[model samples]
Target: MAGTTGIIGGGIVGIALARALSARGEHVTVLEKEARLAQHQTGHNSGVVHAGLYYKPGSLKATLCAAGRVSIREFCEEKGLPYREVGKLVVAVDESELGALAEIERRSAENGVPDLARIDDPSRLREIEPHVAGVAAVHSPRTAVVDYASITEAMAQDVRMAGGSVRLGHEVTGIRSKNGRVHVTTPGSESVFDRLVVCAGLQSDVVARFVGVDASPKILPFRGEYWELAPERTDLVQGMIYPVPDPRFPFLGVHFTRGVYDNVHVGPNAVPALAREGYRWLSISPKDTWESLRWPGAWPLAKQHWRMGVDEISGSLFKPLYFQKARRFIPELKSSDLARKSGAGVRAQAWGRAGELLDDFAVDQVGPVTLLRNAPSPAATSSIAIAEYIIEHYLVKAAA
Candidate 1:
């Protein structure tokens, strides 16, 4: 496979790119460290197909997400997968939040979100979500839900059907560029590729450094913990209930999500992780922890967002507070409505040296290598469009 295109990471973005390349008659190979695909971020997210809300106008995230949602829905329909457009309500509980809600409406309109409406009548809002309490709300009727991990597996199958290999458990230990070829070394063997794309979510910066790229923006892992709604209280959330997000932070505040399978999930509070892959408070890695501390940006970022960070961690440590925060959206939801804590995912958010978290997706190319430097929240929603963007702008242009 010396002349093949190599892609690292088996998550949705990597697999989606592999499918796109193979569809174009290009020989592709995907290398994953895990034993199976979609074991991390792809499988652990809230599974909401964003309707292009909350992104800055004219940005890659805004454009790509707008296109990607349509692409995902089409793909799911073709593959006979579950794609439910149950809709979402971004609620504002008080007069103070109405301003933010209006801003979100403006951004959604700028991004071409279809059928978005501002619901000011509380009774009308209650008709959409019987239990949700908000003075005003932004109803996104097109916002849908799908199982991303299932979609990833389907994409992996397409890769194999197109004669490409999805090699699991193939951890990339080293990467070097020499004489116009990239050599990727593994535990048992090494393979050379004409071009390489790295989508190593948690270890993105570390992987980019293997090819001698600048490592200024380091990856800071933030764990998002969630709780499953009890079976009896699943009706508490009609579709998806979200709060008016704080402009200062990139994360959407804690809310209720009705998954494709009809299970309601309440949570995903963002908390600082002790390690890059740490999903729980007890899961610690000394090396990862030290690297975060050693970076110039980490301390300053902590200093800037310490209050929110402390609140998030406090929510994680105490279920009552977490329940209270979530209750803001659906005022009738009770502590007993939550079952045992569900799964958690670690976000590989990029932080620059200036202590600012990158708010958009970033891609960097070094000759034959394309590295995804920053891809968060909307990434899963934007994976397909991102693949098209990379191929049309980078791969196709390079070949020309």
Candidate 2:
């Protein structure tokens, strides 16, 4: 812990870790592949700071999200950044979804989600979200949103102030352990650090393989596409209107989000991306696609969730299908309200050989090289807390 630390990936989690370590007097350097930080998942997310709604009680997601919300809120206030506690309502659109909604409420309570309210009356649900349609809902008034990209940049500033270095365009090509030190090679640069932490986002497994690690828990990129609401129709949503996510899948079904900028968008229908960083359907990578197809878990995963995959793909290709799904939660929602395809973000979801989605935060160590194999979803919302968790559980042991 007293030595220099080199962090791979320049997303919020990696930046947060660098800041924490730097503040503790550890020499830190961040290597970002892109020209800037947060170019991938961090900058391309919904921006909603989660409030421990759907995660199981006592999970890292549940615990860290609770703590990280407060951390992010404080960070925003201290930096004079925009932080909106716009609240979130997980609605049960019909009687059938009530069971999953109830489970969410229970988990929220167990996770100590602040000021969680269960609304059974339709009128009460209307009071929370005027245009929303739902039989019952679980509302968390403390749920908030912030610009994670801005936060990551601010944290990088803190790292620099604390004598840390952030190097952009430093794509790690190879990694090896030499003489008890980790040597990371970029195209034109060869650098050794006392410790190296791989938070390499989409290329986590690829980087791990450089150190001769197992590729079992592979990254399966799933693209979440969003459609922006027309400016005149933004008022239809007050805060966030989410569906009772199917417990069978890790993805929370497509819902409405009133962003911090006050522009409401509906979307993020999860579909298999042809590339690790695949944003649009046309942005396909043949090698990435072939590797995914060749994975042992690929068949089992497809077999289990092929229907959901087809439905998601259908929504992705056709706007009308996507509109129908959105309109179910808001009766007044017009197909025309979805003005244009805003953008897409590919989530680097980790899956096992048996086709099991690694739902929790996962870490692996090969000597001084610590690979963050899986850090999805609330990883951004729980960034600072994740830094602390990683430091306490992994870094300290490695340093000693």
Candidate 3:
């Protein structure tokens, strides 16, 4: 624990781990590919701090998110950053979705989601969201919002204050274990460390392969597109408004969200990205596309979800179709009410050679190199807890 530790990827999880390791008196250095931190998912997300509503009980997401929700609030308060408990309502627009809504309520209860309640009364649902229409809903009063990029930067500040180093523009080109140490090669320099932790979000699979890890469970990018609400119409959504998620998939359906600054936006229809970092339809990388196409899992995975994929792509292309889906929840939403398309985020979803999507957080140590293979949605919310977990479970044992 007293030796030099190197972490790849400057996203929230990596920075949080660097801070935690530095706090424990280890010499820590963080390497970021871009010139800044949180350049990817951390910066582009809806900024909603999940309240452990959907994850299965006893899963890494459930345990970490439950603890993370409290820790993030405390950390934000201590740092004087903006954190708001604006609440969220997962509404079922019709009787068909009522079953999914009830299951979500059950999962929330199992996960010990704070102040979670089933609102079956139409009048009460109206009280919570006047313009929203739903036969039933599960309300989480503690579901909050925060700027994740700000939190990542603050964590970097904490690392620097603790005498740790943050090296920007240090794109990790290679990773190898020599003797008992790990060597991380950047563009023009190489650094040797007692241990290495890879938190590469979008490039996780490639980074893992650099350390001689398997190629299955490859990283697949799913772009989530959003639309901001008109300034005057922002008043329509008081907090977060969501639809009951499909149990077959990990993505939560398109919904409305109120940011920490009180700006409301809707969307995030999921469509496959041409590149790992592709945030738009036109952003394409031939190398990345070839890699995905050649991967064994891509074809079967596409076959299984082809219909949903087509529907999502159609929704992404046509604004009227997109608005139609959202109108199920907010009946009054009009095409004129939606402003220009705003920010977008690509999820680093992991798909196995078996053609299955990984549901939980995946991390495994190959000697001195630790790879964060799959970390999606609740990752930002659970970053602090995940940092503690890595240090206590992996790094501690490695040092010992």
Candidate 4:
């Protein structure tokens, strides 16, 4: 079939992009490797609609995240989807981290986050979350919680309603550009499109290579493992709670999050994954393992942050250690309070050849193909804005 635009990967970004193009009366087709949409990172996130916190000022993440929060809420309301403005707290447990907390507050303000207030008194903290302990914190009223899977599903519905086709289990093996048309080859057949947008999250590098792009900044999958709080201890957390993140690391610290269903979950320790889709310890892929091990960016990242890696791996294996990290915020936490393993999500973290983590979202255009390389954390919250950006910068400008 012929389409004006072909979107690879049916995660949040791909679905949103397809919907946006189709809404504009363009013929769009989405190719998804999995039978269902959002089967990867989109489905496995904490579902927090961030309030533009923790991102560097004047960066794409800050701009998209700030605008995406509003767009997501409006989209959810229009679609009658479930979402909540439960708010969030970034707590500083020790005096040493107060400066970091202040920096986060400054960044949030620069990003245009509204209704932010500082809470330093223990009494007010108790009123918000009686179980949480912190010497200082920043209260962001705009932080929200939502079901990302539902949002992606709604985007898919909109795509179909706009006369676009979503092809499931159609994985592209190769891509070539010729005569102003791009040809995409899958195992079953070949498809053609005027323009191609590659939103493959974990496999973005591989997808870019097929179209003859350099595919720099290889994706290093970092598995974030989570644990659910026991049902009896759900009241310990009133809303979303987070620890002040270390500036050196990209992953947010283990924090408390209340899902839209009112169930509280704790965790998401960042550890290197053995496979791109490895959700459990026993899950391993030799091809993925070898590729990751031999990547030019892997060893330098390890050398620079070996201590943090060791700590994350230790926390992943030891329940007590995991509880200790959580206890910094909620002093009442106990090892027994943690329930059995729930599930894990692998973050598609991008590492440059120089061993530095890419702090902002990365997109590249070569000829007629556009590859969205690194889109992690805020991508879910920033889907709508990202879609518009892609349409403007990649589709329209590239065509011009």
TM-score of 1: 0.98
Provide TM-scores for the models: 0.98, 0.99, 0.99, 0.98
| Model 3 Cα lDDT, one tens digit per residue, 1-400 | 6678999999999998998888888899999999999999889888989999899899999999998888889999999999999999999888998888889988999999999989999999989889999899999999999999999999899999999999999999998898989998998999999899999999999998998879867988999999999999998899999989986574757889999998898978899899889888899999999998998898998898899999999999999989898888898888888898997999998999977989899898999888888889899999999888888888888778
Question: Per-residue lDDT tens digits of candidate 2, residues 74-107?
Answer: 9999999999999999888889988888888888
- Cα RMSD (angstroms) for every candidate in the order listed: 1.3, 0.9, 0.8, 1.5
Worst 10 residues of 4 by lDDT: 246-255
Q: After superposition, how far is residue 248 of candidate 3 from its true place, in Å?
A: 3.0
> lDDT score, residue 25, model 4?
90
lDDT of 2 at 275: 94
Q: How accurate locally is residue 144 in candidate 2, as Cα lDDT from 0 to 100?
A: 88
User: lDDT score, residue 291, model 2?
Assistant: 96
**What is the alpha-carbon lDDT of model 2 when measured against the actual structure?**
0.90
> Could you give candidate 4's per-residue lDDT for residues 113-164 as a string of tens digits?
8898889899998887789888989998789999999999999998998889
- Model 4 residue runs over 4 Å out of place are 1-3
Give per-residue lDDT, candidate 1, residue 69: 96
lDDT of 1 by residue, 1-400 (tens): 2257999999999999999999888999999999999988899999999998899999999999999999999999999999999999999989999888989999999999999999999999999999988899999999999999999999999999999999999999999998988899999989999999998988899999998999967998999998999988899888999889886564748878999999998878898789888888899999999988898998888888889888898889999989888887777778888897998999988999888888889999998899998888899999999999988887777667
